[model samples]
Target: MATTTDPRIAVLSAMAYPPYNETSESRCTPWAEAVKLLADYRAAVLREAADRLDESETLRDLTDDHMHDVNAAANELRRMASEETRPSDG
Candidate 1:
Protein backbone atom coordinates (compact mmCIF):
# COMPACT_ATOMS: atom_id res chain seq x y z
CA MET A 1 0.00 0.00 0.00
CA ALA A 2 2.76 2.40 0.92
CA THR A 3 4.90 3.64 -1.92
CA THR A 4 8.73 3.58 -1.91
CA THR A 5 8.75 7.38 -1.55
CA ASP A 6 7.51 7.47 2.06
CA PRO A 7 10.37 6.04 4.11
CA ARG A 8 10.26 8.58 6.92
CA ILE A 9 6.56 8.20 7.60
CA ALA A 10 6.84 4.43 7.36
CA VAL A 11 9.63 4.39 9.93
CA LEU A 12 7.64 6.64 12.21
CA SER A 13 4.56 4.48 11.84
CA ALA A 14 6.59 1.40 12.72
CA MET A 15 7.88 3.21 15.79
CA ALA A 16 4.34 3.10 17.15
CA TYR A 17 4.79 -0.52 18.28
CA PRO A 18 5.56 -0.90 22.01
CA PRO A 19 6.59 -3.05 24.99
CA TYR A 20 10.10 -3.75 23.72
CA ASN A 21 13.16 -5.34 25.31
CA GLU A 22 15.57 -2.46 25.77
CA THR A 23 18.36 -4.73 26.99
CA SER A 24 18.44 -6.78 23.81
CA GLU A 25 21.07 -4.47 22.35
CA SER A 26 23.62 -5.37 25.05
CA ARG A 27 24.17 -8.78 23.50
CA CYS A 28 25.26 -7.49 20.10
CA THR A 29 28.02 -5.49 18.40
CA PRO A 30 27.83 -1.76 17.83
CA TRP A 31 26.10 -1.99 14.44
CA ALA A 32 23.68 -4.69 15.47
CA GLU A 33 23.08 -2.81 18.68
CA ALA A 34 22.11 0.28 16.75
CA VAL A 35 19.72 -1.67 14.58
CA LYS A 36 18.10 -3.15 17.64
CA LEU A 37 17.72 0.28 19.16
CA LEU A 38 15.86 1.53 16.13
CA ALA A 39 13.74 -1.60 16.01
CA ASP A 40 12.75 -1.10 19.63
CA TYR A 41 11.80 2.46 18.95
CA ARG A 42 9.68 1.49 15.97
CA ALA A 43 8.00 -1.26 17.95
CA ALA A 44 7.16 1.16 20.71
CA VAL A 45 5.52 3.54 18.26
CA LEU A 46 3.46 0.81 16.67
CA ARG A 47 2.33 -0.37 20.09
CA GLU A 48 1.17 3.13 20.94
CA ALA A 49 -0.70 3.45 17.65
CA ALA A 50 -2.38 0.12 18.25
CA ASP A 51 -3.37 1.26 21.71
CA ARG A 52 -4.86 4.43 20.32
CA LEU A 53 -6.91 2.50 17.81
CA ASP A 54 -8.20 0.24 20.55
CA GLU A 55 -9.18 3.22 22.67
CA SER A 56 -10.79 5.18 19.84
CA GLU A 57 -13.17 2.42 18.77
CA THR A 58 -13.38 4.02 15.37
CA LEU A 59 -11.72 1.46 13.15
CA ARG A 60 -15.11 0.50 11.81
CA ASP A 61 -15.91 4.10 11.02
CA LEU A 62 -12.58 4.82 9.32
CA THR A 63 -13.03 6.23 5.87
CA ASP A 64 -11.79 4.34 2.84
CA ASP A 65 -9.24 7.07 2.24
CA HIS A 66 -7.80 6.60 5.71
CA MET A 67 -7.64 2.85 5.36
CA HIS A 68 -5.78 3.30 2.10
CA ASP A 69 -3.29 5.47 3.91
CA VAL A 70 -2.72 2.85 6.60
CA ASN A 71 -2.28 0.10 4.01
CA ALA A 72 0.19 2.23 2.13
CA ALA A 73 2.16 2.82 5.30
CA ALA A 74 2.24 -0.86 6.26
CA ASN A 75 3.37 -1.80 2.77
CA GLU A 76 6.07 0.83 2.69
CA LEU A 77 7.50 -0.37 5.97
CA ARG A 78 7.51 -3.94 4.75
CA ARG A 79 9.33 -2.98 1.56
CA MET A 80 11.89 -0.86 3.35
CA ALA A 81 12.72 -3.56 5.90
CA SER A 82 13.00 -6.15 3.14
CA GLU A 83 15.38 -3.98 1.17
CA GLU A 84 17.53 -3.43 4.24
CA THR A 85 17.81 -7.19 4.83
CA ARG A 86 18.52 -8.09 1.22
CA PRO A 87 22.12 -8.68 0.07
CA SER A 88 23.45 -6.46 -2.67
CA ASP A 89 23.41 -7.98 -6.15
CA GLY A 90 26.91 -7.05 -7.11
Candidate 2:
Protein backbone atom coordinates (compact mmCIF):
# COMPACT_ATOMS: atom_id res chain seq x y z
CA MET A 1 0.00 0.00 0.00
CA ALA A 2 1.07 3.59 -0.64
CA THR A 3 2.06 5.58 2.43
CA THR A 4 0.99 9.16 3.16
CA THR A 5 3.40 12.00 3.96
CA ASP A 6 0.77 13.97 5.87
CA PRO A 7 0.84 13.28 9.60
CA ARG A 8 -2.92 13.50 9.96
CA ILE A 9 -3.36 11.02 7.15
CA ALA A 10 -0.73 8.76 8.65
CA VAL A 11 -2.42 8.84 12.05
CA LEU A 12 -5.79 8.18 10.45
CA SER A 13 -4.38 5.27 8.46
CA ALA A 14 -2.89 3.76 11.61
CA MET A 15 -6.21 4.15 13.40
CA ALA A 16 -7.90 2.16 10.64
CA TYR A 17 -5.89 -1.02 11.29
CA PRO A 18 -5.86 -3.62 14.06
CA PRO A 19 -4.90 -3.93 17.77
CA TYR A 20 -7.93 -1.94 18.89
CA ASN A 21 -8.66 -2.02 22.61
CA GLU A 22 -11.71 -3.85 23.97
CA THR A 23 -13.17 -0.68 25.54
CA SER A 24 -15.94 1.11 23.71
CA GLU A 25 -14.53 4.60 24.39
CA SER A 26 -11.05 3.57 23.24
CA ARG A 27 -12.40 2.19 19.98
CA CYS A 28 -14.77 5.10 19.43
CA THR A 29 -12.11 7.77 19.94
CA PRO A 30 -9.92 6.56 17.08
CA TRP A 31 -12.92 5.92 14.84
CA ALA A 32 -14.25 9.43 15.44
CA GLU A 33 -10.85 11.03 14.93
CA ALA A 34 -10.35 9.11 11.67
CA VAL A 35 -13.74 10.20 10.38
CA LYS A 36 -13.00 13.83 11.16
CA LEU A 37 -9.57 13.65 9.51
CA LEU A 38 -11.00 11.94 6.45
CA ALA A 39 -13.71 14.60 6.19
CA ASP A 40 -11.13 17.36 6.25
CA TYR A 41 -8.95 15.57 3.70
CA ARG A 42 -11.92 14.94 1.41
CA ALA A 43 -13.00 18.56 1.59
CA ALA A 44 -9.53 19.61 0.42
CA VAL A 45 -9.67 17.05 -2.39
CA LEU A 46 -13.10 18.33 -3.48
CA ARG A 47 -11.78 21.88 -3.68
CA GLU A 48 -8.84 20.72 -5.78
CA ALA A 49 -11.13 18.81 -8.11
CA ALA A 50 -13.39 21.82 -8.54
CA ASP A 51 -10.42 24.02 -9.38
CA ARG A 52 -9.11 21.52 -11.92
CA LEU A 53 -12.53 21.17 -13.50
CA ASP A 54 -12.77 24.92 -13.87
CA GLU A 55 -9.36 25.05 -15.56
CA SER A 56 -10.18 22.45 -18.27
CA GLU A 57 -13.01 20.70 -20.08
CA THR A 58 -11.14 17.39 -20.28
CA LEU A 59 -11.32 15.09 -17.23
CA ARG A 60 -14.58 16.76 -16.18
CA ASP A 61 -16.20 13.41 -15.60
CA LEU A 62 -13.25 12.24 -13.50
CA THR A 63 -13.38 15.41 -11.44
CA ASP A 64 -17.11 15.00 -10.95
CA ASP A 65 -16.54 11.46 -9.73
CA HIS A 66 -13.99 12.75 -7.24
CA MET A 67 -16.45 15.38 -6.02
CA HIS A 68 -19.10 12.70 -5.57
CA ASP A 69 -16.70 10.60 -3.51
CA VAL A 70 -15.83 13.61 -1.38
CA ASN A 71 -19.50 14.35 -0.79
CA ALA A 72 -20.11 10.76 0.29
CA ALA A 73 -17.20 10.96 2.72
CA ALA A 74 -18.54 14.23 4.10
CA ASN A 75 -22.00 12.74 4.59
CA GLU A 76 -20.56 9.74 6.40
CA LEU A 77 -18.57 12.06 8.67
CA ARG A 78 -21.70 14.05 9.45
CA ARG A 79 -23.61 10.92 10.35
CA MET A 80 -20.80 9.68 12.58
CA ALA A 81 -20.46 13.04 14.31
CA SER A 82 -24.19 13.21 14.99
CA GLU A 83 -24.18 9.72 16.41
CA GLU A 84 -21.24 10.61 18.66
CA THR A 85 -23.18 13.56 20.06
CA ARG A 86 -26.44 11.69 20.62
CA PRO A 87 -27.38 10.60 24.13
CA SER A 88 -26.86 6.93 24.95
CA ASP A 89 -29.29 4.69 26.87
CA GLY A 90 -26.52 3.70 29.25
Candidate 3:
Protein backbone atom coordinates (compact mmCIF):
# COMPACT_ATOMS: atom_id res chain seq x y z
CA MET A 1 0.00 0.00 0.00
CA ALA A 2 1.17 3.51 -0.83
CA THR A 3 1.79 5.94 2.03
CA THR A 4 1.20 9.67 2.08
CA THR A 5 3.73 12.27 3.22
CA ASP A 6 1.12 15.01 3.61
CA PRO A 7 1.22 16.71 6.99
CA ARG A 8 -2.57 16.82 7.28
CA ILE A 9 -2.73 13.07 7.02
CA ALA A 10 0.12 12.91 9.48
CA VAL A 11 -1.82 15.12 11.84
CA LEU A 12 -4.83 12.92 11.41
CA SER A 13 -2.67 9.88 12.05
CA ALA A 14 -1.43 11.46 15.26
CA MET A 15 -4.93 12.28 16.48
CA ALA A 16 -6.66 9.52 18.36
CA TYR A 17 -10.36 8.97 17.87
CA PRO A 18 -12.26 9.36 21.10
CA PRO A 19 -15.43 7.55 21.94
CA TYR A 20 -18.65 8.65 20.23
CA ASN A 21 -20.06 10.02 23.53
CA GLU A 22 -16.99 11.91 24.76
CA THR A 23 -17.01 15.53 23.65
CA SER A 24 -13.85 16.44 21.74
CA GLU A 25 -14.55 19.69 19.93
CA SER A 26 -16.18 22.85 21.26
CA ARG A 27 -19.97 22.89 20.85
CA CYS A 28 -19.73 19.81 18.68
CA THR A 29 -20.40 16.13 19.18
CA PRO A 30 -17.55 13.78 20.06
CA TRP A 31 -17.48 12.27 16.60
CA ALA A 32 -17.43 15.60 14.81
CA GLU A 33 -13.70 15.92 15.29
CA ALA A 34 -13.24 12.53 13.72
CA VAL A 35 -15.45 13.44 10.80
CA LYS A 36 -13.55 16.67 10.24
CA LEU A 37 -10.26 14.88 10.37
CA LEU A 38 -11.46 12.37 7.82
CA ALA A 39 -12.71 15.12 5.53
CA ASP A 40 -9.41 16.94 5.80
CA TYR A 41 -7.50 13.80 5.03
CA ARG A 42 -9.67 13.15 1.99
CA ALA A 43 -9.08 16.68 0.75
CA ALA A 44 -5.37 16.19 1.15
CA VAL A 45 -5.60 13.00 -0.84
CA LEU A 46 -7.31 14.80 -3.69
CA ARG A 47 -4.75 17.57 -3.64
CA GLU A 48 -1.96 15.07 -3.79
CA ALA A 49 -3.69 13.35 -6.67
CA ALA A 50 -3.85 16.63 -8.53
CA ASP A 51 -0.17 17.24 -7.95
CA ARG A 52 0.74 13.78 -9.18
CA LEU A 53 -1.00 14.11 -12.52
CA ASP A 54 2.37 13.81 -14.25
CA GLU A 55 2.78 10.30 -12.91
CA SER A 56 1.69 7.14 -14.68
CA GLU A 57 -1.89 6.83 -15.87
CA THR A 58 -2.40 3.67 -13.80
CA LEU A 59 -1.31 5.50 -10.67
CA ARG A 60 -3.57 8.42 -11.44
CA ASP A 61 -6.52 6.15 -12.02
CA LEU A 62 -5.88 4.35 -8.76
CA THR A 63 -5.56 7.64 -6.91
CA ASP A 64 -8.74 8.95 -8.47
CA ASP A 65 -10.61 5.83 -7.43
CA HIS A 66 -9.17 6.08 -3.96
CA MET A 67 -10.18 9.72 -3.73
CA HIS A 68 -13.75 8.89 -4.70
CA ASP A 69 -13.91 6.13 -2.11
CA VAL A 70 -12.50 8.47 0.51
CA ASN A 71 -15.06 11.09 -0.49
CA ALA A 72 -17.86 8.57 -0.18
CA ALA A 73 -16.66 7.52 3.24
CA ALA A 74 -16.37 11.14 4.38
CA ASN A 75 -19.87 11.92 3.08
CA GLU A 76 -21.28 8.89 4.83
CA LEU A 77 -19.74 10.11 8.05
CA ARG A 78 -21.23 13.54 7.47
CA ARG A 79 -24.65 11.99 6.98
CA MET A 80 -24.27 9.95 10.13
CA ALA A 81 -23.20 13.04 12.08
CA SER A 82 -26.21 14.99 10.84
CA GLU A 83 -28.50 12.15 11.77
CA GLU A 84 -27.03 12.16 15.23
CA THR A 85 -28.25 15.71 15.85
CA ARG A 86 -31.47 15.66 13.83
CA PRO A 87 -34.70 15.99 15.82
CA SER A 88 -36.76 12.89 15.41
CA ASP A 89 -40.25 13.45 14.05
CA GLY A 90 -41.51 9.99 14.89
What tens-digit string does per-residue lDDT give for candidate 1 at 1-90?
A: 122334445444434533245677332234443464455445545545555544455664779898677656655665555555444443
- lDDT for model 3 comes to 0.50
**Angstrom error at residue 32, model 2:** 1.9
User: What are the C-alpha RMSDs, in order, of all predicted structures?
Assistant: 12.5, 9.7, 11.6
> Considering summed lDDT, which 10 consecutive residues are worst modelled in model 1?
1-10
Query: Which is superior by TM-score, 2 or 3?
Result: 2
Ranked by TM-score from best down, the candidates are 2, 1, 3
Query: lDDT: which candidate is best?
Result: 2
Residue 12, candidate 1: C-alpha displacement in angstroms? 23
Steric clash count of candidate 2: 0
- Spell out the clash pairs found in candidate 2: none
**Per-residue C-alpha lDDT of model 3 across residues 10-85, encoded as one tens digit per residue:** 4444454323343443333234444555555665555555445434355445666786765665566555545544
lDDT of 2 by residue, 1-90 (tens): 126755456556666653456775354335554555565565555555545545554444566678676566556655554554454453
